[model samples]
Target chain A: MISKINLAFSQCKKENRPALLTYTVAGDNTKKKSLEILNAIAPYVDILEIGIPHNTPVADGGQIQTSAYRAIKNGIKVKDIFKIVKQFKKNNLNKPVILMGYYNTIFQLGERSFLKHCKRSDVDGLIVVDLPWPENKNFANKCKKQSINFIQLLSPTTSDIRMKNIIKDSHDMVYYISMLSTTGGRLKVSAKEILKNYNKIKKINPKQNVVIGFGITEKTISSLTKADGLVVGSALCKTISGALSRGTNPVRTAENMVKKLRSKII
Target chain B: MLKLKKGVLLIDQHDKNYMYGGKFGGNFIPETLKKPIEDLTNLFGRLRYDKNFIKERDYYFKNYVGAPTPFIKLENLTKHLGGAQVYAKVVSKANGGAHKIYNAVVHALICKRAGKKYIVGDTGAGYAGKMLSMAAKKFGLKCKIFMGAKDIKRQKPNCDAMRKNGAEIVPVYSGSQTLVDAVSECMRYWVSNCDTTHMAVGSTVGPNIFIKICAWSTAQISRELIVQLKEEFGGVPKKLKLINCVGGGSSAAGFWNEFIDYNKSQVELIGVEAGGPKNSKLHAAPLTFGSKIGILHGAAQYVIQDKDGQIGETSSISAGLDYPGISPLHCFLKDTKRARYTSASDEEALQAYKLVSKLEDLSPSLEPSHAFAEAIKIAPKLSKDTIICVNSCGDAKKDRAIITKRLGFFR
Candidate 1:
């Protein structure tokens, strides 16, 4: 059977527009609005990456950390993120959903059990930022058995030999972290740096679908449209947070940001 | 050509990662207040060894707090035990006797330097709170102390000292209505109104900055011992070990810093916990039984957290000794096998209290009474000449009535 991920990427390549990836922290500020945000953004975006908040997220910057703290203080448990996903499915938002977070949260929730829960929730993929490629093989195999895609992140730091190994071991598309710093750090590094890393990774595995993420915004999406998919985070999450602070509709704010984001890809 | 001071690790003042521990001790407060916490920690770390801090501390140590708090040589107890020649470093002679003064004085001074007019503190010992209030009064800072209503009834005189120092006693009645509750209340107030307000924590529980201060002040015991024994008894003991009961772990950390690199083969260290025939899971024995590597109050340590990720159960004979967890540095020490930890029950500890009062004319904090209980059991196993040291961390004046009420008068 042609896998769903391959099918999605095949459709992405043919469509010529970069896949619109929208990211939101589940239960940030408020839980009810978080669920609303999921359903609201699903139709506008090609994919949704839901953040599972943790107490100590090692590799996040201030904005996302603040969001994570709010989510945690709201009594949002790791299991509750799955509940929100289930609620989104009940609303018939068929957009592919991925759970993205640090490795500790997944390690704390045993790999086998977490994959099973993801499968039960119809969570299409997993993107643990800190888990490197070959070390994730056991978890990747579990996801494969469950037909869940385990995504790997590649950055400017990836060497040619490492890139080859990572692309070979990865079950899904390689998520290319666009910069060296954390998710919301000022993007002082050029898109050329990421495109340079992208070309190197493509040289190793040309057929592997690669998605660009971290600090993806409308202003920078044009430089990264060559990638099979574009994953938006930080900037989009920050936009929704800004709107929520001003008492604007979070769903509408997310939808508007996605529209602006998708326009850049086209 | 110069013989360098050994065992000292030096770092440049400007190194980015120059904190005592990695991110654990780095000042990560908001930028607006970063300078203050950094200044406070740096100033305190410097003052710990500063001649003035020592000179002023010595005065309190002598006449006011009763310094040279005797190192009573437990000759009969040691001979009976046949283990080590145990000596107690008594700190109970101070106006409000306890090693809590060591840190409390520094905390109050930090408040004074920051141009804060009032000092607020939360305490499990009530001694640290009382000491902070007393220090604040002496230093001309108005102070308020938050204590658990349950603790207030248990430790009445310490509560009175808060009022005597013109400190407003805010009784916390939150979950468990104990020291932990009082701390939570105090923290909530501090975070909301971070003005010219300084909050003094009772023990070396929150941050390593507090540990450095407590260790500095209480290290005087080790310094005095080395001098006294060298001058009066010919030379240092062949092997010297320091034992202090671990509550929030200040006394133990203070005592241990002096002998951090003392040849373990020669000298040994022991930390006693409050123990009874209870499930280790439910007991307040962080070193003996805790399995968590989570943050409590502030720093990461072994805490008795329940399955639902809540701070779990704690138990002790004395209100001062009652805490769910201990200092993270002590946790690190315990894990590295640098120090050994054990516990003694109420029955054994009470007996030790009586034995010490009669034999040595010393009344120790109930917390160390637990340590004495353990000493009684193990003393018979050591050589007659092996020296063991114990820190009587505080005064036992408030404990007599509790003893009378519970077990009748000291037989």
Candidate 2:
């Protein structure tokens, strides 16, 4: 199993480089529009965490939910998302793509089918919010066979024993949820607290790369430096929603947000 | 030529009610959970015919809620209004006062057997939660039910039932503050806490196990009708027509099992969804009108969802018929055109409910009123000798005041 923090360290060959991960729900607003947003974001980010829309996204806050709902309404499915990843690969967008969502969609699609899709779609990893360690052992084996990374999340509520188990079971970078509540709830939790948690996890699994997510806005990206990567979801989704509502160019708007996040993370 | 063991479980091919749906009915849950859901589903199937499960279920039905509910044959109003002879299937006979317990008992048992101590569910009517709680208590399990804060007042009787069963009701004040929000909240809770707790889904939208369990429970109506018709008439009717109301499409699936294979026995299955035209557009008439195949709860099926994949409105008079999606089996049934689908307005269902109560002294839950109203339309078209079966899914002793008040017989 790959430690998330170590994975981040291995990927960071460039000097003074901070990995800026851009998050977007596949086929948000419209498939074409979402594609445009992805293309616009391609130049700025290191990895793309594409959100697969499920009816119930428990871990997500309002903004990601809205984006996911839009994507689902636009007739997006797992196959469609895989197509997006394939297109990304065809374009030589070698930046690793991670598909993130609830496990129901994954389970419904079947574990073997999902891992196959990840492989065929050029998806590098998975971050199923509900698939905690030990429970994911069976799926992790399938992912291993498919050469797809099975990512796990370590929450603040997770005990040291559970953390060690999660770290051991994970095959990709550890996605440390920066907050206790759903995504986009609020930004009350500071970067120091996130970093403190990240450092403790890193000590146990020194080989893993740590990425902080949930409520990591553009303004707060700079404060989250202790981690190898910063994942911004709700803010990106909010920008996409605002752009669509205002009839503004979503690509430019997304690009602008990505630029701002990059500056902050750097 | 076929080697069949004496006790070997074999799906009845000759039974017109069999729903293979071409390999879709098989269980797809984890191998560990496969046996429980399968056993529960099989028990549900056998319960309709098995003397014991039925005896236990009927004991609760007759003594706790009251049973052998009268089938109220519609009066002159249906004829005067150019409608069919509607008959109400009084389901208010089930304890906890709704049609939810028909399958909730099996879910509770499966959970308890799996060493699950706590049971959590989302509810608007609180019927599922209450019935689940009652079942959990009987099986010695702890239960917690999630309800939308706004619905706690409207569905007070259901809440009382839950509390009576020693269940803790968690009020959710999330988005929409209704069944959808409650579902979302409950799903979140389950994902975070599926270790010792088995999330008892309210309807047939989760896994194939749920569909099988519900289908088994509902298949009882058909089995009972087989015996009842043989005794009532000289023989069973050649053509079987079954109707029931659908919310998350559980009860309808249960009753519709007898009519699944249209090619063989020529059984007609009709499911009536709630048509709340006077209400908001968020009503649960997805199969009959608005819907697309999307994942909800845990399965891929038709759902009324907004742009953000959040749950939407499902309008119906019966509290039991107020959910956004139908089961996947219903989807396949619709796709294959094996079953006919329709909807009854709230006014039509209410009128049917009143007619049943006044004429036969039988009170039915609002859910079955949809089927009752549809039966009114369908009965006239059939031969006078034709026998039509409507699942009296629930009885409405609690809704006596509402039914009477709606009829303008009381102040």
Candidate 3:
């Protein structure tokens, strides 16, 4: 079966525009609010990434970390994430949904059981931030066996040799971290610098879809849309958190933000 | 001169291969830390086996840190036990008052060579921090130690000692307010300051490269024990049992590294964990009781956690042993059945602490008191010909206040 992720990338290629990928922590603020927000923005985004709130997201900056803390405070559990993914898939089958988080959550849930839940819930892909390539080959193979796309991550510090080794495995897409800093930090590298590294990776495996993430916001999305996709995580999460703190309806706010971001991609 | 292996130096390969099996070890750092950890891993892999580095380390060990510490027979305790012939490797005789100075000096040397002016680390009982601070002072490097807020209260003297040695202490107030939380805080701090700082990991925990470096540096303890045993027993003991307390498992790794490759049937390696209280919902014995495998401090290991996979709280009278996780090396050893892991309750440890003091006129830190408690339990059942050697890795002077309070003498 062709994965939903591959189909989304193909759709973006046909449209001649970079895929607009947006992320939010599942069960953030409240379960009802989080699901409503995701459902509201599902149509505008080419792909949707839902973070499985973990207590220790060491790779994330202050923004995503706080979002996760709030989600957990509202009593979000792994079962709740699976339920949200199932509901999202049912509501929007055209848009692919990927579960992104640390490996400890999966390890805690048992690898086979977690993958089984992912498959049953129609989770299209997985982006484990901490489980890097080759070190997580076993888990990736399990995901592949279950027909779930295990997205690979390539950072600026990844060596050319290591990149070749990493891309040898099949993946639906590769996430290229734009800078060495965490998710919410300011981008120190210019678009030209990111494009240079992105071109190097494209040279190694031109067929693999590449998405630029980390420090991407609405203001910076126009410059980064030259890649196959752009991931706006911390920026979107910060928006939802900021709106909720002010007693505003975050669902409508996030929907408008996604529409604005998607409009800029053209 | 140590002969260099004649070939292209294999670089950046062991991060995946350094664990017990190729399946265990690898760098799982955040993207922000990839470059620095890679560089440190490469430098450590090269320097740990380099003959010149070894010579420099040995010179520092002999002249500066006073290594090759005496392995005493413990004749009085052995006779009192009336079963196994007992021995203790007196690591307390080393400078900085414990065996931690060995790894501290080696890591400080690495930092100096790499042109890093500052070293950062997390400590449980403050012994490792004090030792590192002393080494940093000697090597002209600034030091910062992140300690748990709870541990600071228990180990006040050692905290004072670390500060006296010119180290800045950062109190951690995260999960459990203990060593596990301190480790998490330290990792976060290192991620931001990795450019000008080197992490002096206090134990054989964290990432694979750090574990390998600590174990290699500390293997000097087992090496000296081997030579001492050879002279005392006319050869290595026929039936040798090695024991040490396990926190993040530095002492056990150091004590058992040399003998792991020996005949499995003839050697027995034991790791003792802190069993805080019997029925009070407090204990740090993850290996003995924990059934879950989780990631903490960048390494995959057995962790004391709840059903939801949240890391649970841990406690021990000895701050060093009060951790929620064990080193991946210990987990591997336990899984492979190469070592036995047991626990001693706070009551048992307290009794053992007083017994060792009364029997041998030597006061042992509560960390090693766990091992001594286990040794006292098993030694009586063994035959007289069998020999058991325990690594007395710390002194008891730092635990005076806590011990006195626990004994009801402070009121």
Candidate 4:
């Protein structure tokens, strides 16, 4: 029973490249434009991560915040997000789709109901920014029951003891927050420093799929290609924001940006 | 927990595993914060019983914070109400003119002990920021205070005072630009620089470690009150009601810390939240309104959020009481039926401020005026032997502009 998420990582590992992951708000510009953007970027991206727009995304930086705010203003509902995922899964190639958000949205939907939606929409993974280890154990178990990969996170500040606990409970993949900052923060710590820490986590369990996220822009993505996977969120979100301001379709711009990111990581 | 020479208990003996207890107050922060949070938890746990730390804390509480703040009987208000005897534990006598400095002092000292030179904090009405700035200046640590842009304008004097105390003020302009956003931004900033910085959370509404730290530090108020009660009434009186305003529940936590173990028949605790404007639909009374359980900032508690779980916009004339969430301790207390929760509307709080000023010749900050309003409402219904003690948690000087604009007298 190999999950699409695991398959993506395995395929990338076989190809000697890190899996390319892209994150965008579910209804960033509009309902239709979001679907178009997802479709346009699907070819280059190994894993497509959709953000559930929350009013207060404290963990997210300005670019992702703006995308979330736009989707929220458009009155995008949770069911609407599931619909988008279902449509994207139906119309596109079989790439893994991971829904990333804070825990409250899932709490609002109830763990069972939210997992049901995820299962129906063919969502392969979930990355709840707020639900870290220990507290997330119950929800992670619930996510497992639905066969969805509940991605656990590890940060540089995470001690080896806690890192072991998180990795043990992690599903198919684990997300390594590159630094101790919100998404889209400056690269305060150099790539060498981040990878040094990443390599330690890797040494703890080499077989586990670990992806590096946060501050993964074009300039930095190439430097991070040694990791199992790379997540580019704010950069692609900034592309969408730029396209909207210039009165252009974000689909092509997002596609091109993902292609560029894929080029670097692969 | 040590009982210090100044007749104060450092921490509650029964508060075992206060960080994540009984379905509330877990550390729900990002993994980047796990190290600092755990480090703080361990340090605070060790310092609670340390004799040297207790002595140093009491030294500041007595001389710097002006502790054992006058427990003055409100004779006029008691006679006017014609039922219960009223008293106020004047926490405004504390340094920074609010109970906030209690937490600020402990956090600054903790930062100093942790060997960090930078301390960050968040403020809604600027009390925590002002207090943190003063404490940081005293401790020779660089201070950064995150405040909402909306608060920066209304709480200008406090902001100016923070600047005077040499603290850098970071204005958070996102998501209603109020206390909640300030806290969010402060936590966001801490995620990056936590290795060398200590985040002095303004209230007991954040992560598990912060909630416990705030509750433990602010418990100094109750340590003072326990002795004051015996001094005032010769002993603990029958039908004692302890009231304090509940925003993030710091003042109330401090006010009722010792009384938590008291029998329900002996002591009644009341927490008054902001009920917003009288005719409007918005309010900050989450616990009173039976807000659905949801996670906000870093803990799971009763929060005002939509069915979709988006944190709702909250409003109150007092910026301090305008947060959408409350302390997890209060949440636990409310569930256990150990305390009563209520709300005071903006109009009622303003009216209480006017009445108390005319009668007591002492004005309270809008935050505590809500508690006073609750006391005023229930005083007439009780017996003459019933004693009502309200923690006048802050001075009214901070609300001069809003008071002048609303009721036309604070100028």
Best by DockQ: 4
Per-residue lDDT tens digits for candidate 2, residues A14-45, read 54665778789988987777777888787787
True-contact fraction for model 1? 0.00
**Can you give the lDDT of residue A132 in candidate 4?**
79
Candidate 4 per-residue C-alpha lDDT over A86-160 given as tens digits, one digit per residue, 9 for 90 to 100: 999987647899999998899889989999999999999999988878878888999998899999999988988
TM-score of 3: 0.87
Clashing pairs in 3: none
Chain A vs. native, model 1, TM-score: 0.94
Cα lDDT tens digits, model 1, A1-266, are 55556777777778877677777898886788889988877776777889887544434565676677678778787788888898888875456788887654564466777877888888988886545555467777888888888888776555566677778887767788776556675665787877887888878878888888777777878888888888877887788778878998878888888877777887
List iRMS (one decimal) for every candidate.
11.8, 8.5, 2.4, 1.4
After superposition, the stretches of candidate 3 with alpha carbons farther than 4 Å from their true spots are A1-3, A6-18, A69-75, A108-110, A168-170, A189-192, A203-207, A217-225, A238-266, B1-23, B29-38, B75-82, B189-197, B261-267, B383-386, B409-411
Compared with the true structure, what per-residue lDDT tens digits does model 1 show for residues B1-411? 211123642111112422333322222221122233445677776766678866777776665555565667877666566677878777666467887776677666667657788778888758878888888887888787888888888888787777888888889755556776676566544533345577777766654454455555566566666666676558766776677788777777766665666666666778887674344434556777655654455445666654323455566667776777776656656665667888776666778887877677677868888778777777767776777777887777667667777667753
DockQ per model, Cα: 0.04, 0.15, 0.32, 0.73
My TM-score estimates for the predictions, one after another, are: 0.63, 0.65, 0.87, 0.96
All models, RMSD in angstroms: 11.2, 8.3, 4.8, 3.2
Candidate 4: regions farther than 4 A off: B1-21
Q: CAPRI verdict on model 1?
A: incorrect
lDDT of 1: 0.69
Q: In model 2 chain B, which range of ten residues has the least summed lDDT?
A: B8-17
Q: Kindly give the stretch of ten consecutive residues in candidate 3 chain B with the minimal lDDT sum.
A: B1-10
Query: What lDDT does candidate 2 reach at residue B287?
Result: 87
Best by TM-score: 4
CA displacement after TM-score superposition, residue B230 of candidate 2 (Å): 2.0
